[model samples]
Target: MKKTLMRPVGLPESASHPVATPLMPSVVYASDTPDALDAQYEGRVAGYTYAREGHPNADVLARRIDALEGAEGGIVTGSGMAAVTAALMGLLRAGDHVLGGDQLYGRSLRLMRDDLPRLGIATSLADPTDVDAVAAALRPETRMVLIEVVSNPTLRIADLDGIAALCAERGILLAVDNTFTTPAAIRPMERGADIVIQSVTKLLAGHSDVTLGWVAARSPEDRKRMYDFAVTTGMTASPFDCWLAERGLMTFGLRFAQAQATAERLAARLADMPGVRRVLYPTREDHPDRARAQAVLRGQGGNMLSFEIEGGRAAANAFAAGAAGVAFAPTLGDVGTTLSHPASSSHRGLTSEARAAIGVTEGFFRVSVGLEDADALAATFEAGLAAARGA
Candidate 1:
C-alpha cells in the first residue's frame, strides 16, 4: 500500500481552502507535474503505459539516483518492505532458498524467518562479517543473497566485494540494502553488488519529512524483473513523496558530508568518555571492516555512530535520557541529532538468541549525526556521559 503524502492537514500555505487531505486511492492526476505530462505527448511516449507503471517525477528521480549508483534503472516503492518483498517475490518462488546476513532490519528478518518459510522457501542466516561464513551458508537451491551494505544497530559494514565475487562465481543474485551507506558514501554496484535496494526515507531525502523506498538494478534484466514485481504488487511511492525526495536530494551531497564529519568527530571522542566502552565508526582504525569500507566508499563514513556505554544498557539509557539539544528519537537521517536504543527499537523483533548472536547488547546506543553545530552536539554528549557516570 502506498503511503499518503503526509502534508499538514489544514490548507495549502497559499490558500484559505481547507488542508491537503490524504488523497483517495483514486488516481488524482499528480497536480505538481504538468511539464512532464506535456513532454510525454510531444514525440516521446517513452513506451510508458500509466502513472503507476511509470511517471515523470518518479522516473526522473529514479534516473538521477541511478546515475549516482551507476545502475541501469530504479524502481521506487511505497516503503522499504515493498522494495524487499518485490525483489524476492519477483525473483524467487516456492522451493527456492536464500542465504541472508543475520543482522538484518527486524522487518526483513521477520519476512525471512516467519513468512518465507510458510511459503515453502527456505533461508539460512550467517555472520556477514566473515566472508567465508557467507559462502558456506549457501546451498545449491539458493537463488538470492540478501545483506545490508552496512548492518543496522551494530554498524557492521559488510565485505561487499567478496560477497559480490562469490555470488558472481555461482550465478546468484546479491541484493544489498544500501540504506546506511547511501550512494553518497558507497556505490555498492561498483564493488560487485548486483541489485541495490534503498530506503530513500533515510540519507537520500536527508530529512525526516518524507517516506519513500526504491531499488536500483545494475542490469536490464534486473530492472525488468523489479518493475514487473513492483507494478503488480501495487506498491509505489506517491508523486508528492517523490517530489520531496527529489528536493531533498538537491542538497544531499552537501548534507551527507557535514553530518558524517560531525559523526566521525563524535565517535572518536566517545571512545574517551567514561561510560563509552566501545565506539563503532567505519572510519575508526579499530573497526574490523576498515579496509573494505575504505575500498568501496567514495566519501567519509556515514552519519550513524554506535557506542556501548560502561554500565551497559542501563548506562546507555541514562545517557540518552540526560542528553540536551539532541532528541531521543527512534529514527535516523534527520536534521537533528537522533538517538536510538537498538535493542528496544530497531532490533526488537529478533529472538533473544538471535540478538545475542549479532552482539546487539543492551548497552548499545546508535547516534545519527545531523546538521547541528559539532561543538554543541559534542557538549550535549559530554553532559550525557557525565550524567551516566554520576548515576
Candidate 2:
C-alpha cells in the first residue's frame, strides 16, 4: 500500500502522439542513477535536470522560432526585456559600446541609457531610419547596433538593409528587435541582422496571455553565449507560458492578417476624420518613412497605428472614455482592439522634450487593431473623435 501510494501506477506509452505539444512542467527531472544524472548535467546526453538550465517546452518553442526567423540557433527567456538583456549582456563586455535607435520603447531606452552603464557598458542613441546617422554615432568601442524593425507608437520603419550593410562594413553586430514586426511581416536575419529579438508576449503569442520572449542568432556561438547567460541568471521562461505561446503561434498568421486589414481601413478613415491632427501608419501615403516602409515591410502596415487629437491630453482622455467599444490599455498585441496613451503609459518616463523629439505627444493615441469588424471599429473611432472635439 505504501509503495502504491509513493509511486502511482504509470501509464504505458500511447500508440499515437498528441497533436499538441506536451506540456512538461516538472521543475526537477530524475534519472535512473547518479552516473546517468551526472552524464546529463555534463552534456553527454540529451536531457534536462533543472528547469532553469533548460526545458523541453522552451527548447521546442526556441526551435520553432528559429525556423520562423531562419536563425542558426535560439533561446527563450522569461520576458521580452529578459531576452533583450540576455542578448546584450551575453555578447558585450566591460568597456563595450552599443548604439540603439533614439525612438525605441521607453523601457528599452532606459535599459540602455541607465542600466548598461552601471555594468561598464557605454551606450548611444541614433536615428535608425538613416544609416548615415547610425554611422555617425559609431565609436571605436562600439560592438553592436540595436534597432526595432518598426518604432513603437510612432510607426517609423527602420532601414534594415541599410543599417545591416553599415554594420557589416564596420564589423559591428546588428541586433534587431522584431516585436512589432513579427516574422509574418519581415525576417531581420534575411536582411543581414546578426541577432533577431522578439517579445513573444506580443504578436507571436497573439492572445495576451503569455509573457515570453526569444533571441534568435545567426551563429551558434552567439546563441550559446545567450543561452548560458539566461541559464546562469534564471531568465528562462515558464513551461506553461512556452506551451501557451506555441498554441498562440498556431493561429498567428490568420490573426495578424485580419488585424492588419482592419488597421489599414481604420488608418484611412481616421486620416479624414475631423478632430484628427495626424495619422501615423506605414502604408499611408504621407508617412514620413513611406519609402523605407515599402522596402522593409513590403507594404504591410501591420496592426498598429497612432493618431493625434487636436486637444492634447484632455481630448485624449475624452476619446478614451467615448471609445467604449475598445478597451484603453497600456500594452499592445492583444487579440481584441485596444487603445494606449503613450504619454501616460509606455513613454511616461521620458521628459516632455524627449517625448516630443520622438513624436509621442500628449494628443497621440496608439491603437492596436484586432479581429473586430472594420466598419464597427471605424464607428468607434468616430465616436472617440467626436468626444475629442467636445473636449
Top candidate when judged by TM-score against the true structure: 2
Steric clash pairs (candidate 1): 10-19, 11-19, 275-310
- Model 2 has a clash total of 0
lDDT of each: 0.81, 0.90
The digit string of per-residue lDDT tens for model 1 on 1-391 reads 9888765355347545624323333343432366666665463545343667766667767887888788877888887788888788777899999888888877888889889999988988987878899988899999999999778888877778888899999999999988888888877788788888888888888788888888876678877888888988788778778878888888888888899999988888788877677899888998877887777664368999888776766677778878876888778888788988887888877667767776777777888899998878888988988888876
**Predicted candidate 2 versus true structure: per-residue lDDT over 199-269, tens digit per residue:** 99998898889999899778778888998998999997999999999999888899999999999999999
- In model 1, the Cα lDDT at residue 18 comes to 29
RMSD in Å for model 1: 7.3
Model 2: how far residue 101 lies from native, Å: 0.4
Task: Kindly report which residue pairs in candidate 2 clash with one another.
Answer: none
